[model samples]
Target chain A: MLGKFIAGKFLQYLIVIFLMLTLNFLLPRLMPGNPLVFLAGEDVGFMSSAEKEAILDKYGLNDSIIEQYGAYIKDIFTGDFGYSYQQKRPISELLMERLPWTMLLTGLGLVLSTIIGVMFGAISAWRRGTKTDANLLTVFMFLSAMPSFWVGMILVSIFSAQLGWLPVFGAESAWSNYSGIDRIIDIGKHLILPLATLILISVTSTFMIMRYSMLNVLGEDYIMMAKAKGVKEKVIKYKHAMRNALLPVATVFMLSLGFTLGGATVIETVFAYPGVGRLMFESVLSRDYPLIQATFLIITFSVVIANFLADLIYPLLDPKVGSRNG
Target chain B: MNTVLSVENLSTYFKTDKGIAKAVENVSFSLNKGEMLGLIGESGCGKTTVAQSILRLIEYPGKVVSGRVLLNGRDLIKASDKDLASMRWKEISVIPQSAMNALNPIFTIGDQIMESILIHENVSKREALKRTKTLLELVGIDGERWRSYPHEFSGGMKQRVAIAMALACNPKLVISDESTTGLDVLTQAQVIALIKNLQKKMDLSVILISHDLPMVTAICDKIAIMYAGNIVEWAPTEDILKNARHPYSQALLNASPDLGNPEKEVVSIPGSVPNLVNFPNSCRFHTRCPLAFDKCRQENPEFKEVRNGHYTACFLEGVGNHG
Candidate 1:
């Protein structure tokens, strides 16, 4: 039964990816524009008609829509994302360079925020109706309402422009030729503001959900039984109650992890970080069709895969799900 | 006989916007070692409250306003938090209502039982696991089933698991608070039988809290009938069954169906349990009592002994009338 369920889920995700790929190929082409113009940029006016034809031909833009789509599918399968018109480089190479920065920024932010948020949430729920709970609720409510970029800007104005404690933008010091740990430290310093912005903005949802979930679990008879059994207060709260409460939050964590992989565009833009989010933002503005398509496809696939994992892990977290499916 | 638990003038009240709801007021009962005392009551008569008060498990909006729960001579109400913690599973434990929700869904049955043993005893994990398997077997479940989660079991199995968990630390007293509530009739009977068997074999004192009068009459050594947070009558099983003094107790016996005497009418009590908020200091059952007189309304009757091991709180029983 478990094997069958996994197989079914895998099939569903595969369909989702196939549909996303088709849409990715079609959506960019459906936009009313000439890729040759985007490719030429300022050189568009100076380029002869013959040169323009050569450029279009090189990109296979002169082929029929169906023929181009077939090649697009084949190219994706072979790990080739074609070329970026705006950057004058391969789309795959551009993504490769930007993906790690996005991963570092969002990966660290997600891990830290989830740990801090889930812990605070559990504590807040445990101390429900108390001053600490009320205060946390108020702060998270404000954070949930505020935009990430606005938070980034405020943080920049305070920490960068005012105190000058951290860098205002970019992923590293531009002029530094520093190597070894110094270079690492320089990069680390630059990562702080955007990373902080991501954490503050993202943490509210997790905290709120966890608090709500924990409050529900606290009322379960098992928790009362645990208390009656003389289980330590900490063990009851963290192990018995929080373990069950974490079911819903696990899904939230997995979803955010997938979304974060695409990068926090607003945060990346605010910090001028050379991450995938920033790359996608620039691609959209310049209508770099290949880059935009490649980024969106990767993001969509990542989300589908993450959702699949959540489905697989849910039965482990909640045995009831497994029985029901079986 | 040595008393295992003695509850004296125990009162638990819930603070509400309307007023203080006297859930369990001036309740008193004593259970001898290895005795099964059935705390039988209507739905709102505060049976669970009395149990929680005894365990000192009452939380916010609810307080054990006035009580003395002496378990083996130690006053639990005044016991320090650490003292209480040490006593909880080791000295006394509860088999909660809805065994369905009483076992943590995420944890294995063995792990949950082992947790209780490991926390209170200076045993290694291996020793705890070994003890957990034995407890499961004692409760009529396969020792190997300890690895299963609550959801992996049937309702009866989950209840059995709950029973095993209750016995994890070999508690001197176990309170089964409607632990058989949601099970089918056969499952309920099986669970209760298991408890009775374990009680006898282990010499464990148990408070079987339920509204199932017939079941209580069958297994309990003594019975306390509650009416609107007051213990209207308390006596040995035979005395309560054959010579009930309180109006509520007699009414309860009349209401229950008799299998042997199939021709006998099953009559339900006339009125619903009274609301307890700011309840007047009079007979709580006066409105429902068929024999209620003006004197019954003028003052509350005291729970006084009329026969050896039999007590009742009713003016009709020739008890003193303060008014």
Candidate 2:
């Protein structure tokens, strides 16, 4: 049964990738602007008719849309994303350079949020109806409702400007040319504002979700059974109740992983971080079709993959889910 | 024989919006080693609450006021949280209702049982697993089936697994709270038989809490009937059925559907359980009692022994007979 579930999930991943690829190929073309106009700009007089035709032909812009789509599909299978007209570089290389920074920020943010959120949620639920729980829940509700960008601005204003504690923007030190530990420290310092903003905005919502889930699970007859069995409250919460409560949270986490990657575009731009979101923003402004298409494809693929993982994890958390397909 | 568990003057109430809703009032019972006591009551009569209170499992808004629950002479009500923790599962365990849901879906049955064993005993994984396998076999499941998850098992098998998990520590007392409520008749019988066989072999005391009087009558050595959070009558199983002195106990016997008397009509008690909030000031059961008198309306009855081993809380039983 376990082997079959894993194989099914693997197949699902492949299907998601295929769907994402199709979307990536189609969505960019649906937009208003033409690639040639964006690339050549208003200075079309610089090129002769022959040179212009040759440039169009070389880039496959002269081909019929169907033929171009077919060629795009074939190239995708060969791991070849087309060259960027604006940057004069392969789309793959551009993606490779910026992907790591986005991952670092979002990945670290998710991990920190999950840990803190689940812990606080469990504590609050355990102490339900108490002043501590009431205060914590109120704070969580307030934080979750606050906008991420607004929080970012406030954090930057206070932590960076007023306290002089950290840098407000960018991924690392631009002037020092530092590497290793110093570079990591500089990058860490630069990350504080965005990280705090993401954490503050996310932790409350996730904690609330976890708190509700924990409360519901704690009310299950089995929890009462555990208590009757004389199991300690700590063990009951951490072992029996929390494991059951985590099912919904796991699904939410998987969904959030996708949203965090694609959704952080505005946050990246605000922080001036050289992540994929920042790159996508720049690509849109520069009308760089190759860069835009590549970034969109990556984001779509990441989302699909995250959802696929979430689907796969459902059965592991709930045994009944395994029998659903069978 | 030494008493394995004792509960005295236990009263549990929930502070609701309306008022203090008494769930279990002045309820008391004792179980000797290797004895099986059946707690039978209508729905919402606090039978389950009595079982939960013994374990100190009652959650917030509900408080156990002025009670002494002693396990092997140690007062559980006065025991510290740490003391209670050490006593749980090691001394007393519970087979919870909804057997399938009781087992964590994420873990294998073996892992869950091993957790119970590990909590109380300092043993190696191999040793704990060996004991788990033995327990499964004892509960009439194949020892090899321990590796399987709960969803893999049928309802009866899942219930058996729960029983095995509860007995992992070989606790002195096992509280089965509606353990067979949702199972089919055949499965229910089989599970009860398995519990009976194991109880005898392990020499463990058990508090069997259920709404089905017939099932309890089949297995319990002693029986207690609860009505609106109080023990209306308590006696040896046969004595309670053959010569019930309490009006509530008589009503329950008449109400129970029995196979031997197919011609007899099913008699349901006239009224439902009284709402805990704003319950009658006198006897809580007086509003529903058929033989309630003027005295019963004005004053609550106190528990008094009607016979050497039989007790009832009712003013109708004549004050002189109580002694």
Candidate 3:
């Protein structure tokens, strides 16, 4: 039964990947204007029409739309994502270079926020009508309502500008000739503002979902049964109630991971962090079709895969889904 | 017959927006060791509230306003959180109304059983697992399904798992609240029979709460008929069936389907119970009582013994004088 479920989920992921890849090919090509002009900058006006045609033809942008699509799909299997117009480099190479920074920022942000959120959420739900629940819920509500990028900026204004506590720009220092742990520590210092901002924003969204879900789970009959069965408050809250409540939170967490990518776009721009989101932002403005398409494809793929992972992980937590009845 | 549970004038109320909703009021009963006592009532008659209040498991907006729930000589109603924590599942445990909802869905049957065993007893994981397997066996579920989750089990099997969890700590009193309602008829019989067999084998005292009269009578030696938060009558199962004197008990008996005599028309009591927020100051059952008189409409009858161990709270009989 579980095997069938896994197989079905895998097929669903494959279908999504196919549709998204097709969209990646067709979407940016539909936009007008050539990216070669932006890459050429001021020299574009001086160049003859024949020169423009040559540049377009060289990148295979002059090919028929169907041929381009076929090449796009074929190139994907070959691990090629075309070439960046501005960088004059492989789009795959460009993204791979920037991917690690974005991953470190988002991954650290997501993990820390999830832990903090689940703990606070469960506590708030347990306390329900108390002052602690009220205070934390109110603060998180305000934090959630504030735009995350703006929150990032506020942190920058306070910590970087006023307090002079942390750096405001880039993934790491170019000036410092340090290597190894010293360089890693420099990167960590630069990471604080962006990571903290993401953590604050993500925690609000996550805690609210968890708190509501925990409250509902706490009301379920089994919770009361646990109480009647002499289960300790700690055991009942964490093991029984939190276990059931975590299911909904897991789906939300996966979805939030997707949004954190989108948030990184705004955050990277604010911090000037060298990440794929920043690359995507810059490429979109320059209308770098290959780079834009590749970045978009990666974002879409991450989201779809995250949800697919949720589907796979959910049945492990809930045996009802592992059975044929599910 | 030594009294195992002695509840005196137990009253539980809910603080709703409207007013204090008396869910259970002036309800008193006693259970002897190794005896099954059924508290039978229709839905919303405060039977479940009585069960929750017994364990101090009443959630917010609900409170045990007044009462004494004595188990083995200690009053649980007055016990501290620390005392109650130790008392629960060790001294007294409850089998909830719906077996399907009572067991946590995420937990395996073995884990759920082991949880209670581990909680009230100082035992290792291996020992708890052994006990869980034994408890599952006691409930007639195959020991192999111990690691199976609650959702993996069928409704009957879930009920058995609940029974196993209830028995894990070997509590003195087991409160079974509508424990058979959610199952098929066959499973209901099996569960009741299981409870009966377990009760005898373990020397247990049970408060079997259900609306099904025949099902309750099958196992319960003593029975209490409740109406609108009041225990209208208390008697032996056979006495309540053969010589019930209160109007509500009579109506309750008539309403229940006669298994042997299918031709007899099942009589359903008229009018739902009044809104509990502002329950009638007089007899709570007078509105639905077929033989309600001026006295019943003006004054509530106090529960009193009319015959040896047979009690009723009705002014219709020449007993329970309101003045």
Q: Which one wins on DockQ?
A: 3
User: Quick one: ranking by lDDT, best first?
Assistant: 1, 3, 2
Residue-level lDDT of model 3, residues B1-323, one tens digit each, is 89999988999999988999999999999999999999999899999999988898987788898889999999998999889999999989988788888888877878888888888889999999998898999899888789887877789888888888888999999999989887989989999999999999999999999998988887789999999899999999899888888888888888888889999899888888888897777899888877788998888898888889988888766745332
How well is each residue in B102-144 modelled by candidate 2, as lDDT tens digits? 8777778998898888878999999999999999998889999
What overall lDDT, based on C-alpha atoms, would model 3 receive against the true structure? Answer: 0.87
Provide the lDDT at B77 for model 1: 99
TM-score attained by model 1: 0.92
True contacts kept of 1: 0.90
RMSD of each: 3.1, 3.5, 2.9
lDDT preference between candidates 1 and 2, better one: 1
Candidate 2: residue A24 Cα off by (Å): 2.5
Q: What tens digits encode model 3's per-residue C-alpha lDDT throughout A1-326?
A: 66777788889899989999988888887789767777678898899989989877888879998898899999988989988887789898888889889999988889899989988998899999999999999989888888878998999999999999999899998778879999999999999999988888778867988899999998988999888876778888878888889887787788867645543888889899988888999898889888898889888888987888778777787777666434
Off by over 4 Å in 3: A1-12, A32-49, A258-263, A304-308, A323-326, B122-127, B293-298, B319-323
DockQ winner between 2 and 3, please give it.
3
Local error of candidate 1 at B85, Å? 2.1
Worst 10 residues of 3 chain B by lDDT: B314-323
Deviation of model 3 at B153, angstroms: 1.2
Tens digit per residue, CA lDDT, model 1, B24-59: 998988999999999999898999999999989899
Q: Quote model 2's TM-score.
A: 0.90
- Residue A270, candidate 3: Cα error in Å is 1.7
Candidate order by DockQ, decreasing, is: 3, 1, 2
> What's model 1's lDDT at A139?
94
Q: If you superpose only chain B onto the true chain B, what TM-score does each candidate give?
A: 0.97, 0.96, 0.96
